[model samples]
Every structure is written in structure tokens, then in C-alpha cells.
Target: MGSRVMPQGAQDISDPFIERHLVIDTSKVNRNAERGGFTNREQNGVTDQVSSPRRSEIVNRSLSAVKSFGNDDIDLEGGDVEKDRDKTIRGSRIVKVRNQAVLSGLAYCISSCSMILINKFVLSSYNFNAGISLMLYQNLVSVIIVSILSLSGVISTEPLTWRLIRVWLPVNFIFVGMLITSMFSLKYINVAMVTVLKNVTNVITALGEMYLFKKHHENRVWAALFLMIVSAISGGITDLSFHAVGYSWQIINCFLTASYSLTLRRVMDTAKQVTKSGNLNEFSMVLLNNTLSLPLGVLLIFVFNEVDYLSTTPLLRMPMFWLVITASGFLGLAISFTSMWFLHETGATTYSLVGSLNKIPLSVAGILLFNVPTSLQNFASILFGLLAGVFFAKAKMREKSQS
Candidate 1:
């Protein structure tokens, strides 16, 4: 077809394509222009296209074909935009996960350190003699808080049926013994020394795992364990205010702690068997242990002759003492929840690593806060033990990854 040129400033309405082939829908376009979706420059371009057509219909048809084929598929800028959008989404998700893990780790460290300090204060500072009673009170607080949470639907917990209780009873006894001995040891031993001595539990647990679960460890793990033993012995020998009773209690506590760990692993399988869902969660285990400990704790209190001590102790009369003890109880519950959360958010290896490294700051805090008497030799031993713990965790992690 031949084309004709129009006069300057004259509007061309030759084709009238929309009016002839399709119904016109200018209302929505006009509304959009009024709403700013179509800017003044865009509106002027439309007016120019109607008044003075610069390109032919053949060029317009080619542009329409390019648009229909998808500009993003062929254009490098569009591809780059898509990649940037995807990167932004993935980066946001990574940031969220990292934030959660860091928060959970901090919570675990604070609650664990605070719980130990509170117990030490009550036992040594306040001169409280009733270890079993203290444990009982803490467990009672846990039960009360957990029950309230369960009732309010803030958390879920498995029901404490008779079968579940029976399965958990053995582990509960070991758990009680562990807590009582730990409390007793903290009465005389300084927190730093106590933390160093706790490395023994890891060694015992490793040995127990080998024998009972048929698990084997790498040479580095054994080497780390040996370093732990050496550090503990050196720390003890150099301790200026070493108490025979405290060391004895801590040795017993270590064995009990190892037993509790090994026993709990077996008990978990049995516990799950009793549940209808065949799943046992961390909160359920927390509730079970604390709930079952109450009766055993009460029995132990009488057996330990702490009832008379509690009756005569004037510290109980102090509101500040009561407040500190109550806070310890809450911190105990917090430890359980935070530890579980941290382990879930990260992994077992990261949890152990953080736990081992946590003792460094905790030991320093303990020494500074309580004015604990210590020699340079003993302090060196403490640092050695802390490093050994970190090495042990890394060794275990490496061993796990290899297997």
C-alpha cells in the first residue's frame, strides 16, 4: 500500500483500527492516567502517536511480536533483575536462620550460667545446707510453670501416664542424684573449679557410650579426653581452698551425670513406646523429669535430714533469699527450653561447641563475681580445662561428620 504524508500540526485518523475492529475502552485508560499510572510524558507520547505517526504499521507489528515473545527472556537486564530478586529472597532467609541460631545460643548460655551462679549463691553465700530441698523447690517451680504453659496452650507436653512415669523413674533417680551432688559440691568448691571438674562427665559418657552403645571415638577425641583429665587433676592439686568433701561430691556427681545421660538415651526409646503418637518431645521429657523428681526429692530431703536444717535456717526468712531461689527455679526452666531450642536451631555439634566455650566466660564471671580465691597455677589449669573442652567438642564434631 502507498503511504501519504499529512500536513504539519494536523491529526491523522486514517485507519481507526480500534473503532473498526474492536470496541474502545478509553474509560479505564483515562482513569489510570488520572491516577498517575500513565504519566504526562506517556500521555503526550500517546497524543503524538495519534497526531503524527512516525513509524509504519509493519514496525508496530514487529514490536508487538517482540513484546509477546517476552522481553525478559531475551533481555540481559531483565535476566539480571530476576537473579537479583532471587538472591534477595535467599539472603533474607539465610539472615533469618542465622539470627534465630544466635539468639538461641545466647539464651542457652545466659540461663545455664545464671542457674549455676544462683545455686552457688544459695548454697555457699547463704550457707544453705538443704541441697535436696533446693532441688525439690526448683523442680516444683518447673512443674508449676510447665503445667501453666500446657494449660494455656503456649506449649505442648506429653501426658504423664503411669507407663511413662514408670519408664522415666530410673532416669529420674539418676537425675535427682546428679542435681543433689552438684548442689552439694557447689557449696564448697568454687564455680571455676566445678566447671573444670565437669569435664570428667564427658570422659565417663564417652566410655559408657563405647561399652553400652558399641560406639567408638577417634584418637583426637581420646586425646582431648586425656587432656581434660590432666587439667582437672592439675586444677584440683593447685586449688588453694580445696575441700575433700566438695571434690568427693563432684566425683560422685560426674558419675551420676554420665549415668543420667546414658540411661536417658535408653529411656527415651522406652518412653516413646508408651506414647500414642510414638514421639517424645523435649518439653515432655522436661516435665516428666521434674514431675517425677518431686516425690523422690521429698523422700531424699527427709533421708538427708534437711528437714531439721530447713526448720532452723534463718536464711529462709529473708525475702531476698526467697527471691534469689525463685529466680533460680525460673532459670532452670529457661535452661531446658533454651538448650532444646538451640540444639534444634543449629545442631548437636554446634550446641556442644557453644556449651564447651560457654564455660570460659562463665568461669571468668564466677571468679570475679564471688571473689573466689585462686592461685595462678589453678587459673592456668582452669584455662587448660576449658581449652580441652573446646577441643573435645571439635573432636566429637569431626568424628560425627566422618561417620
Candidate 2:
């Protein structure tokens, strides 16, 4: 060995060194067999033995991590599914609301048309205070109808009290004014002209809002208002045929109607407050207003010498009269419900826009059904009326934005 210790070829190992290496490898193999019963291979040689319990714990931890990851993925997928379902429900609700608004607008237009047709065809056939008497009878009939509905639990009852009465008094006056002025105007003017002239209320409402309510408007709204006014005036003038008394009554109608609309907005707001306070119900307010008007309507009939025309037998005998009265009452109730529904669904501006469109059909119907004449001047009046409505709408929109 001393002779060959000759560098051991730098590759050959001595007996003692090789024996020691073998012993170490043997010990490692035995330890692996005793513990895990296996050994891991390595590039250099062999890896040290790992414990069975420790290896099992390591494997278990990895499996737990995988399972947790799978659970997290499942939770995320479930959340995504719920979110999608909620979005689908919300979209459906929006569609339902839009449909309701359209239906309400159509109902309002139909009711208005029915009223006009009845006034033109049926009431015109009767004599003095015929319109007034018809109105009075209709109110009485309405009271009965409403009372029946209330008793039947179809309509909810409201309390009667001074505070509630006072709040609605002004609104009731405005309502009466609306009915009276429109009827009076119809008596003097043709339906087409009346429809066209009604547009003027838009301008009055705008002016009232600015002067009385001190509302500010946007430039676009002002521009639209101007355009609407121009359109109405042009339309009216183009279709004009002068009937001084008719025109006068129409103007009065416009004023009264504008007042009614403006006053109603305030009254409705106040009524809501009173309702919340448990002082009144809307149905009760309606009943009280009509009941109080019973006396006023009767007095007016006598004052206007319309009592002579008011024959209980003749009125009852006339099927057409009853039809008109029935139609009018139904229309009135429908208008109330539809207008409220429209406002709830689409807001005031949309309501006004639909109202403006109503004139077109009404005017056409007036001309075709009632033979109401149209001229350049009348057209201009229509244009002006339309313009006024547009302007009023703009003013309202601007005020809302500012607020």
C-alpha cells in the first residue's frame, strides 16, 4: 500500500476509507428500512432517510391545500351565479315600469278623447245649463258610485276634517274652474279650436312658475319653450277663424286650466303630507269637494237661469244624456288614476309631453267628428299653445335640475 499509495491513481480508494463509506451507506439503508422503508436517489449518491410520520404529514398538508383551493373556486362560482341572477331581476323590473308608463299615457289620452266626444255630441243637444246640469248630475252620480265602491271595500275611505277640507278647498275651486271654463269655452267655440287654444295654458303655467314660484330655467329649456310657443302660435294663427266670444272663453279656459294645474301640484304635495299625518285620505277629500260643490253647482244653475232646462224627466228620458254623463264620470275618474300613474312611472315632463301629443288627435277628431273649422289663425293659435307647453315643460325641468 505504501508502494501503491502512489497517488491511488487519484481515483482508487484505500481499504480503510472504502470500508468506512460502506458502513455509512449501510447505516442509512437500515435507518430508512426501520422508518419509511425507502430511500430517495440523488445525483451525488443517496439522500438521507425521511420519517414515515413526517412524510405522511407533508402529503396530508398538500392534499388539504388542494382541497381548500377547490372549495374557494366553488364559492367564487356560486357568488358569480347569484350576481347574475340579481342583475336579471333588476332588468325585468325596469322593463315592467316602462310598460306601465306607456299604458298609463294611453289611458289618459283615451279618457280625454271620450270626454270631448261626449261634450260635442251629447251635451250640445240639450238646452240651457244643460252642461252645468249635466255636470251636477254627473257629480252626484259619481258620489254615489264612489260611495258604493268605498262600502264594497273597492276604494279606501278617508277621514273628513277641517284641516283636510281646507287643504283641498283651493284645489277643489281650481277643479271646478277647470270644468266650468272648459265647458263654457266648448259652448262658444268648436272642439278643434278649443283643443288648440288649450295649449296656451302651457305658457301661462310657465309664467306663473317664474313669477309666482320664482323658478329659474336652463337655456335649452328656454329655447325649447320658445320653439313650442312659436309652434302653437303659428299653428293657431294658421287655423284661425274668429269667433270673438268663443276666443274669449277659450282664453279664460286657458287661464283657469293653467291655474288648476299649478294649484294641483301644490295641493297634491300638501295632501301627501296631510295623508301621512293621518288627517285625510284622498278619497275623502274628493267626496268632500264634490259634496260642497253640490250647493255651488245648484246655485249656479239658478243664477244662470238654467233651471228651466233642467227637467228631471227629460234628463232621465234622454239615453244620450245619460250616456254622456256616464262617459264623462268614468273619464273623469280614469283621468285622475291614469295621470297619477303616469306621473309615478315617468315623471312630470313625460306626462306633459304626452299631454301635448294629445292635442293632435283631439284636434283631428274635433274637425272630423264635430266639423270644427280650421284656418291660418287657428293654426297659429295651436302653434302658440304647443310652444307654451314646451316652454312650461322646460321651465319645470330646469327647476328640477337646479334643485
Candidate 3:
């Protein structure tokens, strides 16, 4: 056959193109090479060789899975990133709350301890020994201060009414008794022993909680109470200058302290219900308690013959005496305010436990201030008591977390 050459090449039969012949190029070229040497199942212009429905579906599924796997990687990484961000925000909030609580607790502990130490000074160092009179003045300070604050709108308080007063009057009685007995004990007991004996109050409170609130105690709580009792007995035995009367006063103080706590919890609710201002906060309770205690304290003052002492006392003539006394009053009110703030920010268990923790430093400070005689044995007992307090706090925290 005669044929003309193409522009760039001579015609070959194996070529897919032969321009002069104008042949149709309907053939697959380098089929295996195009598929990277893989099998060409759709050969010979037919795709039925591997066209079983199940096989086709399997291949489609594999391709789809590969495509989706990449998308899933992206989605998973994004989701984890978002989750981590949310966790970071939550962690920050938790840390902030914890810091606030710790700071409040610190304020409460320092203020409370200072009030006690100053009170011990007023009673023991100053030879006041007039528990009722001291309480009366402190309560008067509280009333005056709280009134000023409430009127000035610095702190909101419910208005005092006869109903609310009646509801809180009983708890106020316990509060007064607690204060009086505490002063009596402080007059005779060293600060270290005072703190050791106060562990008994925790026992009484735990029992009261179980009975009043129908709460159950774990074995850990019982063990802590046992340690507290042992600490008290050991402290008493080692106390070189122990006074039976002082110990008796402290024992009474424990009962009244526990009673005041349990009763106050109930009374706070009852008083809140009768409040006219629809706001029965800690300030209102402080006002009601101290304002109502004034009359009772006055009566006790006369009964205890402090009226005669004040009339004859040269301390009344001393400006320093009045200044210290007034300072004690301020600290007392500070105790009340910080105590409420701590309890508001944290829980009751935390408030009570931190209170126990506070007594440790107070005991040391008191011993140093008064030069109260303390042997190593007595110090050991005091340390024992402090350790018990720490364990009790931890147990309480665990219980709270579980609940």
C-alpha cells in the first residue's frame, strides 16, 4: 500500500494514530502501565468482569471510608481542642473560688484568734474577771456597730421585730452563756489548755449533728473524737497549774458552745422566716443576738456585783484601760463579721474546722503573752490536740466530698 508520512513521524501499524490512513483510535494504550501494573478488570471495552454487586459495593465502601477517615481526624482534633478550652475555663473558675475561700478563712482565723487572745488579756492580765460585764460591753459594741452599718447601708439587715426577737432570744441565751463561761475559763486556764479542752466541743457538736439533723457518722469521725478525748485528758494531767474550777467552767463552756451552734443553725432559719425586710443575713442575726443579749447581760452584771466594782474601780479612770477594752470590743465585732463571711463563702464544716485550726496559733500566742507555765509534756499534749483538729478537718472534707 502507498502511504504519505505524517509531519513528524512515519506511520507504524502498532501506533494508535495513522493520520494518512485516518484510522480510528479505539484502543486502550499502555493499560497496565496507566494502572501502575495493577489488574485492569474493565478490559476489552467491558466492565462486567468484576461487576458483581457485592464487589462493587465493597470497593465503594472502602473508598468512602478512606475519605471519611481524613475528615474524622480533622473533626476529632477540633473537638479535643474545644474540650480542652472548656476545661481550662472551668479550672480557672474552680481555682478562683478556692483562693477566695482560703483568703476568707484566713481572715476569719486571724480575727478570731486575736479576739480570743485580747479577751484573755482583758480578763486574766487586767484582773477584770468580770465575765458578765465584759460580755455586756462587747455586745453593746456589736449593737452600736451593726446599727451604724445597717443604717448606713453598708450591710443589709432585716428590721428587728418582736417576733424575730422572740425566735432568736433562746439562742441568744446560749450565746451569752457560751461567752460568760468562756471568759470564766479564760480567767483561770492557760490558752494552751483552753484550746486542748475545746476539742470536746467538736465531739459534742458531732453528736448534736447526729441527733438533731439525723446525720450519720463514719468510723473516721468516731476515731477523731476519741483522739480529741485522749488529748483533753492528757492535757489535763500534764497541766501544771490546773484549776478544777477553770476546768469545770471550760466543761460548761463546751456544752453551751455546742448548744449555741446547733441552736443557731435552727434559729437562723426560723428568724429568717419572720424577718420583715425579706433579708435575714448574718448581720441581722448578729444584731438580734447582741441587741437582745444587752438586757440579759445587764441583769447578770448587777447580779455578779460588777456594778459595784465599776463604781469603785480605778481602771475606769485609766484611758489606756478604756482603749484596750474598746479595742477588744472592736475585735469581737470583727470576729462576728469575719466568721459570717467565712461561713458564707465556705461551708459550716469548713468554718468549724478552721475555727479549730485557729486555736493552735492562739494557744501559742496566749502562752507567750501570759507566760503560762508549760512543760514539754504539756506542749506535746497541745500538739496532740492540734493534730486531732487537723485530722478532724480532713475527715470532714472527705465526708463532704463523698456527700
Candidate 4:
């Protein structure tokens, strides 16, 4: 009844499908061998009594048996092919991630070094005494750019509520202090010594971590910190153009920098609670910091009497001056963006490592580009300080991995 009701061609099509999968099993073959139906003659010591046609027939059956085993192997080979394809896909993704990390790190290094050099040119070379105004203008540029990007949906940022602003106010104040002191120090100090002196920030941060967060450090970390101190002192002693005011400002900058880091870490969670998304991204932080700084910066301009200087300075009349300062502003934004990008793509470990290594080229470029006075001893001390930073980063990485 089933055959009678089937379609005209259904039986023929179904026959091959069933036959392909219903090949002879190994157990059936073994049973046949025990029954002496198709056994190997040599294994049983049987004589060649069969005719030549019969022998040819046995050989054909043996070939069919081997082909059956090959069928199973084909399925396994198909699985291996699938695995290889997956591996290829994963390898391509990793390459793409690595490329992104490299690009971000390079952008960070270029923007960072360029920002410092440009600031030095405007402050020292151009003899511009208005550091606060410069900081204000650069930050204004950042605020404008970030606002545009956020509105255009090119990046995501948390909405800034008053609560969030209040939560971040303390950190922003320290941020202002850090930036102002850094600018004052850079105005009088050569770039190389400034870079070396900045190493003290790490020591301060480590101590802050120990005292504030109740964290402990490995002995290797302490050793690296001590080395950093030695290098800073040695560098200062050998500096050919040492300025007491510069050194004092730098010491304050270090403390403020450390304070900014510690305070930001503590306040971040509280700030997030006030945000619409309950998450504050790097862009939001950049926008918030720059926006909040504007009013404070204005007040500072009045206190420092920079408005009169800005009004009278002939450098403002030159289109070239505007171009340079504007470029520095863009580079300032680039530094912020690329630093976050590098950290996101490669994690903090690689970011810290690259940052440590970046000081070397910056030091050399600062001396050569500005022709800052330097002796062999000062250069050695700078190198030592830079190496100490690298050693510190390595120690922290090892300690993190072990923990």
C-alpha cells in the first residue's frame, strides 16, 4: 500500500539515500569471518583451491571493505576542515586587534610629545607668560570638539547632570592645580628635566595607594621608587639651567598629579551613580573636566592679571601664532583621546609600558629641538630616571600577574 501511494520518482530517489548510509557494519563483517564466508586465506593457512575468478571476486570485496573505513575517515576530515577555518578566522581578528593597538599607541606618543613641545615654544621660546590663559584656551578647544562629537553621535558620552558635576568637583580642582603647576614648571624648566621630575608622580601615587587604599607593594616596586628618587636628585644637581621656582612648581605638580589620580579613582563610582547611563566613559570625563575648568580658568585669568597681557600681546596679532596655538589645542585633544584609545585596546599594562618608553624620544627631541643646555651628567641622570620608570612599570606588571 505504501509503494502504491508513493510518487512516481520517490522510490528511486529514496533508494540511494538509504543505501549510502546502510553500508555493511564491522560487526557483520566479523560475523562473516567467523563463519568462514570471506576470511583471509593466509590467516587460516588455507590452500589456493579457489578458481581465479573467485580470487578476483574476493579481492573486490576486500577493496569494498577498505572503502567503508575510508567513509568514516571522511567525516573526521570534514570536522578538521571546520576547525581550521575557525582558527583562521580567530587569527585574523587577533591581527586586527593588534593593529588597532599599535596605531593607538603611536597616536598617543606623537600627540603627547607634540603638545609638550608646542607648549614650550609658546611659553618659553615665545616668552609667553600667560600659562593659565593658554591652558584655558586649549581646554576650550577640547570642550568644543567633544561637544560636537557627542551631538553628532560619533561617540557616546554620559549626560552631565548637576549631581555628576558636584561629585567630580574635587577632582577637577586638583586637575586644575596639576595643569597650572605643570605649565609653570615647563615655562622655566628644560623639557628633559621636566620629564625626569615628572617621575616623582609615580612615587607619590604608590605611596598614596599604600596609605589611602591600604594596598601593599612588592620590594621590587620600592626599589624602583628609590631609584627614581635618586635619578631625580642627581638630574636636578647636574642640571645646567636649574631654576628653583621651576623645581618647586614641579614638586607641587607631582603631588597634585598623584592627588588627581587617587581622588578620581575614589570618586569614579560615585560619579557614575549620578550619570544617566550609570557609566562614565572617557569622553564624558574629558568633556566634563574641560567644561568645568572653563569658569575656574576665567577666575584664574583675573587673579593672575592675564587679561591685560592678552590684550596687549603682539603675538595675538600674528596669524602664525593663532595657528600654532590652535594646533596645540587640537593636539591636546588628540592626546586625551589617543591615550584612552591605547588603554582600551591594549589594557593598562601595555599602555604603561609604552608611556615609560615614550620619555626617551621626548627627552632627546626636547634637547635637540629647543637647544636646552645640558651636560653629560645631566643626560645620564635623565636616562637613569627614564629606566627607573620602565623598571617600575615592569615590577607592577609582575606583581599584578602574580596576584
Candidate 5:
């Protein structure tokens, strides 16, 4: 057939008759090319060979069409896409949790250091009883400030109810115990020694959890607990001196701290039920606890006959006193939040280990800042105690893994 040409704009060249004829003509040409200089028998022998390339060319053209439309690309099924998204989300969550844990640890350390500095500086310039009074003043001021902030919407407001008050009452009592004992320890002991001894709380808490709450722990936890006890005792014996008042207060501080942690955990677990509220924010708890302490502290000041010191000395008027009190209060709050957050993020054992590491820097800072004299024996004791804490913590983690 001669080349068939379409008229100008002839219905956009839609012609099945022309297409059929063109295909027939192309087939004839391919047959002629295959039989070039070959007899019929030879052409028959090469028929399969000639058909193979033609089939391949058709396949290639089809593939090219698919490529042009991007249809040949692999299409991930719905399930596969969802699984990939889930994996990404899980990874992000894990990273976020770990970051929170680290931030909490650092905050606790910084707060601890700040509190130590402020307390030491204040005590060096004032009487013990007077310093206690100043602490009370600081709490009072904090409560007032926090209350104002809450009302102004800078801080969140917590619902106050009888049930909430009942639950918070005991916690505040424990808080008071911790504060008074810790402050008393500062009077006779260096900040470094006090911090080392503070590790004893971990041991005490473990026992309290086991005995009181019936919380089962792994063998490693017990081992860690044992190490902590031994370390604390050894550290104490090595660092022992005739500072009876300070030593006694530190022992009380340890007990109080342990009590605080145990009680706080219980309170946190049952806060919603006990308060008849959905959940209580930690800031609200802080506010309530500190507010309750104000009256108790005032009453204690009178009982201890420290009201005279407050009246005679212009401690409140001194900028140094205000500075120390403000700094210490903020540090106290920071430490409180960080420690709680760490416990929540990494569990008790890891939190305790991090706390143990904190003692070294605190001890060094104490000696340097307060001129705390230490014998070689005392230094050795501290080192041993720290090592024991590490071993115990590791053992506890191992036990947890096994269980």
C-alpha cells in the first residue's frame, strides 16, 4: 500500500482501517527481510531466531512506555509503609526519653551544688539557729511567690480539697524532717561528707520498698543495696570525728530522705485516687508541701528559742542573707524536680548510681569551699564507698536483666 496521508485535521487521525493495513504491511516487510538471500528451507530454520528479536523489541518498547509513566517503580504496600512509620516513631520516642533522663540527672547535680554553696556560705556568716530561721523565711517567701504566680497564670493552679490535703499532710511532714535534718548536718559536717552519706538513702529506700510495700527486687538489687550499706558505713567510720551533733543529724537526714522517697513514690502512684482528682502536678505538690511547712517552721523557731536571734540580728536586712536564701530555695526546688524526674525516667537503680557519681564532685567542692580537713584514711574510705556503690548498682542492673 502506498503511504496513506490524513486530510488536514481529519477527525484527529482516528482510523482502525488504516492502522490494520499498516500493521499488515510492516509484517510483510519483516518476513521479506528474514528471507533475504535464503531459500524457503533456510528461512524456516531461522524462523525462531528472527521471532526472538522481534519479541524482545516489542518487550523493550512496552518497558519504555512503563518507564515514561513511572509505572515500573516498586510500590510499597500499605502494611510496609505503616511498619516503617511505626519504626521511625518508636526511635524518636526512645531518643526523647533518653534526653529527658540525661537532662534530669544534670539538673539534679547542678541544684545539689548550688544548694551546698548557698548553705555553706550562709552558715559561715550566721548562727545555726539563725540559719534555720533564715531557711524558714526562704520557704515562706517561696510559698508566697509561687502562690502569686499561680494566681497570675504564670504557674499552674492545683485544686485543693480535703482528700488532697490528707494525702499531702504526711508527705509534708517527711519533707520537714528531711529539711531540718539536712540543715542540721550542714552545721557540723562538711557539704562533701554530707553528700556521701546521702547515698545511704538508696539502701534505706530499697529496704523500705521491700519490707513495707512488698516490692520484689532482683538479687543484683540486693547486692547493690548491700554495697551501698557497706560503703556508707565504711565512709562514716573513716570520716568519724567528735562532731556528735552533726553526725547524729546526718543519720537522721538519711532516714528522713529515705522516708521521703518511699512516701513520695506511694503518693505518686495513688495521687489520683487519694486526691479524688485525675492527676496532681508536681509543682502543685511542691506548693502545698512548702505552704504547710511554713506554720510548722514558725512554731519550731519559737520552741527552739531562735526568735531572739532573728530579732537581735538584722539578718533579713543583709543582702547576703537574702541572696543565699533565694539561691538555696531555687536550688532546692530544682533538685527536687530533677531527682523525681530521673527516678521516673530511668528507674530507681540507675537513679541511685547517678547519685553515687554525684558525691565525688560534691565531696571535692565541699573540701575546697569549706576547708574541710581530711586524713588519708578518710579519703580511702570515701573512694571505697564510691566503688562499692558502683558495684552494687551494676549488680542490681544485672539482676534485673536476669529476672
Candidate 6:
């Protein structure tokens, strides 16, 4: 009677059915290895064998379930097996994500530092004092590259609308100001010294975060900020050739630079709403940023009286000049692409930290490549400054951890 008749719903709880849906959590496998998954086997000098009672109990239950299901003429797709496989796939995906993030950060650092050095060479060595003209040309190059990619369907971006452009205008203004002042500052400042001085941007950004967002910094953060200030002052005074105009422009750049990063965060949400694709991708931001800068760049070119120089300059006719500037333009685009890639993969904090970490090598390269005059004291100050940057990055990361 027991074999021939069954209660209602008894089939639902049968071994076959249970085996198909039963999922055993293997998450404890690693934990059990520490204290539970070992057995003594001194006869063969195998002190640790995988014959522990806990492990045997789990294996026996799983095998018994499979055998009972088989006896019942049922095949189990194996819920526990599926789960374990899924867990393995998820673990690999997590590793892949981290690897990509590290690669992105590295690429961003290389492009950013190299772009600065190349631009400095073009402006200083090539005798191109027309910083705005260079910026205009570089931005135009970025626009063209992005356009070609979009047209070829290798990439996609949103169409321009006045409503969208208007929402982005404020951020664009700050961006233009940052770029122009960067050019102005780089013109007269040595690359190493420029990097050291630019540390002030962090201070300005922190102040903006505190005042605007009402976020407070820890004491360690404040101390790091103080070190940055001292380094900046000492590095400034020890400079072999200090340009007042350059320093002033860089100071302005600090504020604008900080403002760009902070404002970009606030505007990103709104910028996404108006895009033709209704998605704000890196290419779209690149397109919008470089495109908007063009008109303003033209105005600045006129305001700075570079048009006359552009018309008469023999460098404009030189193929080598074109080649170098074109390369710089490509590098400029690379910087934008990589910067966005890194920011996207790693978030703002890691992006900022990697940037700060990159300044040391960039500074050393600048001094060596450009043959900038430096004394022991000045070099020490730059070192101190770079270390201060490292400290600040750590402080920010720590504060983030605690919060």
C-alpha cells in the first residue's frame, strides 16, 4: 500500500523533485577548510587528508540525493551544481573588472603626463606662444576624431540640442577657463615646478567640498593640506626662474580646475537628461566639451590678438610644425578619452589619487627632458611636494573609508 498509493502532494516532496530544486550553499567551503575539513592519517605520513566528518557528511547527502533521484527514473539538472558554477563565473567577472580598472588608470596616467610634456615642448621649444591657438587646434582635432568614429559606427554619441547644450554651458565655461589657464601657466612655468604648484588644486577642491557640500575633513587630511601649502611656497621661492604671470595664471587654474571637477559631478545627472540618445556616454561628453570650446576658443584667439601672428607665422607653413602640433592634438584626444575611461572605471576618488601619484614621475621627466635648472634644495622641495600629494591622496582615501 505504501508503494502503490501516495498522499496528495507527496510527489511534490519526492526525492527526484527535491534533488532538482535543492540548492546547498557551498559558501562555507573556504571557511570550513580552516577548522573542519581535515583528518589525521599518520600511518602514511599524510597528517592532513580530505576525509573530515563535515566534508563526508555533505558529500554523502549530495550523492544520496542524486542516487535516489536516479532510482526514481528522474534526472536532476542539479541546483547546487548550477549555483556553484554561477559563483565561479561571478568570481572571475569580479577579477576581470578589477583588472580592467587598473589598466584604465595606468593608461590615463600615461596620456595625461605625456600630453603635458608634449604640449610644453610644442609651446616652448617650437616657439609657439599662441596657447589659445594650440588649444583651439587640439580641441578641433578631438572633435574631428570623435566625429569620424561616430560616423563609421565604431562609436555612438548623442545629437546636439540647444536645450541640452544650454544645460551644459556652465560646465563648459569652467572647462574652457581651466584649459586656457593651464596653457597660460604651462607657458612660463617649468614642468616640474608646474606639477608641484598644481598641487594647490587639491586644496581648492577640498575647500569647495567642505563649503559647498558641507563635508568635513579629518585631522590627517588637514595636516596633509598644510604640507601641500608649505611645499608649494617653498617650491615657489626656490625656483630658478619664476614667472609672476605664470604663477598667477596657475593660481587661477587651481580654482577653475577644482570647480570643473566639482561642477561636472553636479551637472552629469542633468546632462544625461537632454542627450539625443538619452544616455550620457564618454564620447558624448568629449564631443560636447570640445565642440563648445571651439567658439569660445575663437573668441579668445581674437581677444589675445593671435590672429595676426597666425597669419604671418612661418611655423604655420612648416610641415614639421604641423606634424608636431597634429601629434599634440592626437595626444590631447587620447588624454580626454583615457581620462574619461579611468574616471568611469575607477570613480572620482581613485581617478584623483592616480593623478596625484603620477605627478612624481612626470616632474622628474620634465626636469630631465627639458633640462630645467634645479638645485638640491629646489629638487628636495619638489620631492617633498610630491610626497605631500601622496599623503593627501591617502588622507582622502582614508576619510572615504571612515565615512
- Runs in model 2 deviating more than 4 A are 1-95, 125-129, 166-171, 218-241, 260-281, 312-316, 380-384
True-vs-predicted CA distance for residue 4, candidate 5, Å: 93
> Considering only N, C-alpha and C atoms within 3 Å, which residue pairs clash in candidate 5?
220-396, 224-392
Model 2, 188-217: lDDT tens per residue? 666666655555555576678788889755
TM-score versus the correct structure, for each prediction? 0.80, 0.67, 0.73, 0.78, 0.68, 0.74
Best candidate according to TM-score: 1
Q: Global CA lDDT of candidate 1, please?
A: 0.72
- lDDT of every model, 2 decimals: 0.72, 0.55, 0.68, 0.73, 0.59, 0.70
The ten-residue window of minimal lDDT in model 4 covers 1-10
How many pairs collide in each candidate, listed in order? Answer: 0, 38, 0, 0, 2, 0
Off by over 4 Å in 1: 1-86
Per-residue error for 91 in candidate 1, Å, reads 3.2
Question: How would you encode candidate 6's per-residue C-alpha lDDT over 154-218 as one tens digit per residue?
Answer: 98879878988999999888878777887888889998888888778768877887999898999
Model 4, position 369, has a per-residue lDDT of 93
Best by lDDT: 4
Candidate 3 clashes between residue pairs 3 or more apart in a chain or in different chains: none
Tens-digit per-residue lDDT, 65-153, candidate 4: 66556543222323465456556766777787779878988997787778788888999999988999988888888788888999999
> Which lDDT tens digits does candidate 5 get at residues 1-403?
0011111111111111110000111111111111113122111121334357778778656655554465323222323554565567667777877797788778766765666667766776465356457557667666666677789997684767777777778877777766777677777777656655665766776678789999777766666557656666776777744377887887887777667666666675555676545755545666666777788888888887888877777776889767767766666655545655555565555654565566567677777776777888877766666666566556655655565
Candidate 3, 1-403: lDDT as tens digits:
0011111111111110111111111121112211122222221233455568898778666655654564442233235654565567667777877787888888866765667777778888788857788778877877788889889989887878898888878877886777788789878998788877877877987888899999987788789889989999999999998999999998998888677666766766567688776546546666777778889989898888888888887877999988887887777677655654565566555555555566667778878889988899989998998788778767766776687
The count of backbone overlaps in candidate 2 is: 38
Off by over 4 Å in 3: 1-106, 277-279, 340-353
Error of 1 at 33 (Å): 45
